[model samples]
Target: MSKGEETKTRILQQAAELFNQQGYAGASISDIMRVTGLQKGGIYNHFQSKDELAIQAFDYAIASISKHYRIAIRSKRHAIERLQALIAVFGSFAENPPIAGGCPLLNTAVESDDAHPALRERSQQAMNSWLNLIRRVIQTGIEKAEVQNNINPDEVATIIVATLEGAMMMSQLYNDTVYMQRAVNHLNHYIENNLKINGTS
Candidate 1:
């Protein structure tokens, strides 16, 4: 990459970390600049304003989360195993957060509500993408007879998304992983009892 491209990427990476750690509202352009060791003019040369940087930072965070899930799912061959792998990814976050600030999607969603339109939309898109991926995986499991044919992929996806996000939030707030663990346990049970073929209960 060119020097300019490298600098821009560095700014975005630092901005993403700050946004995740503090928040869109809590984090300032000065804070980002301080973290990146860039002058104000250097930051402005890449991004027009702090709002633009916030949007880009949110995109970067979402992409990171998506990349992790993609890798986790790709490692599994079976459709059911892939779906389980996806859930396992979230479950493991309680023990090992992918990013230091916990789930970025949940963080942005909570903080950006009615505050930053661009950032909020970016977060929403990320969540929708995540839900759609889960839904597709469930659909594949059903088609392959690994999951029950009668299962509702959309509903299952919604529940999975909601439960995982909620768990992450609760875990972060309480500074405890128990809620996350319970959420994952329930999620695993749902998959085994509702989705799995052979009626394992």
Candidate 2:
């Protein structure tokens, strides 16, 4: 990458963590300067405005999260196993998030809702992508007869995402991983018993 391009990327990476850790409104231009080591003029040279930078950084953060998930499920063959892997991914988020702040989806959703239109839309898009991915896995499982044919992919995906997000919030709030751990354990068991392996049922 060219020098300017490399600098722009570095800004995005640093700003992503800053925004995730501090809400969009909570993070100021001075904060960005502090994080990126770039002056106001240097920052504006790349991003048109703070709003523009915020949007791009959010996209960057979500992309980072998606990349880690792709790595987590890359080797799994079974759909149930893939879903279980997702649970483990969320568990890891509590300990070591793709970004420093925690789950970008949860953080952005909570902070942006009814507040920032641009960032809110970005969070919704990222969530839709996540939900669709989960739904596809469940649908594929049904097709492969690894899970019951009657299983509702939409419903299952919602349950999985909601459970993990809620658990992560509680964990982060209490400054404890046990809540996330409980969520992971419950979801894993839910897959084992409720989803039931093809022949196990």
Candidate 3:
């Protein structure tokens, strides 16, 4: 990468963490500068405004998490295994999050609801992407006859994603991992008993 590209990436990386820990409104330009060791002019040369930088930073964070998911679920041939991999990686957030604070998508969704329309839209898109990933896995399972035909992919996907996100939020708030573990465990049971074909492994 060129010097400019490298600097921009550093700024985005620092900005992403700062924004995740302190919402877009709470994280000021000075804070970003502090984290990145960049001056105001240097940051502005790369980003038009804080809002623009925020949108890019949010995308950067999402991309990191998405890349991890892609790699984690890549080799799983079975539908249940793919879904389980999804759960496992998400649960891993408690111990090894891609970002500093927690789930960037969840945090931005709540903080940017009425604060920043662009960020909120980005959050919505990230959620849709996640939902689609889950649905695709479930759909593939049905096609392979590994999952029950009667199962609704959309409903099941929503439940799994929602449950996991909720578990993460609660775990963060309570400063405990039990909530996430319980959610993950219950999700495992649900996938095995409800989604998987009775005789299939």
- Measured by TM-score, how close is model 3 to the native structure? 0.98
Residues 93-125, candidate 3: write the lDDT tens digits.
977889999999999999998768999899999
Error of 1 at 46 (Å): 0.9
Q: Residues 16-113, candidate 1: write the lDDT tens digits.
A: 88888899889876798799999999999999999998888778877877887899987686766787788888888877876678888888888999
- Top candidate, metric TM-score: 3
lDDT of 2 by residue, 1-201 (tens): 999999999999999999999989999999999999999999999999999999999999999989888998899989888998888987889988889888988999999988899999998999999999999988988888888887889999999999999998998899899999999999998888878664742
Task: Go through the candidates in order and give each one's C-alpha lDDT.
Answer: 0.85, 0.91, 0.94
TM-score of decoy 1: 0.94
Better structure of 2 and 3 per TM-score: 3
* Candidate 2 residue 46 C-alpha distance from true site, Å: 0.9
Q: Give the TM-score of candidate 2.
A: 0.97
**TM-scores vs. true structure, each candidate:** 0.94, 0.97, 0.98
Which whole-number lDDT from 0 to 100 does residue 38 have in model 2?
94
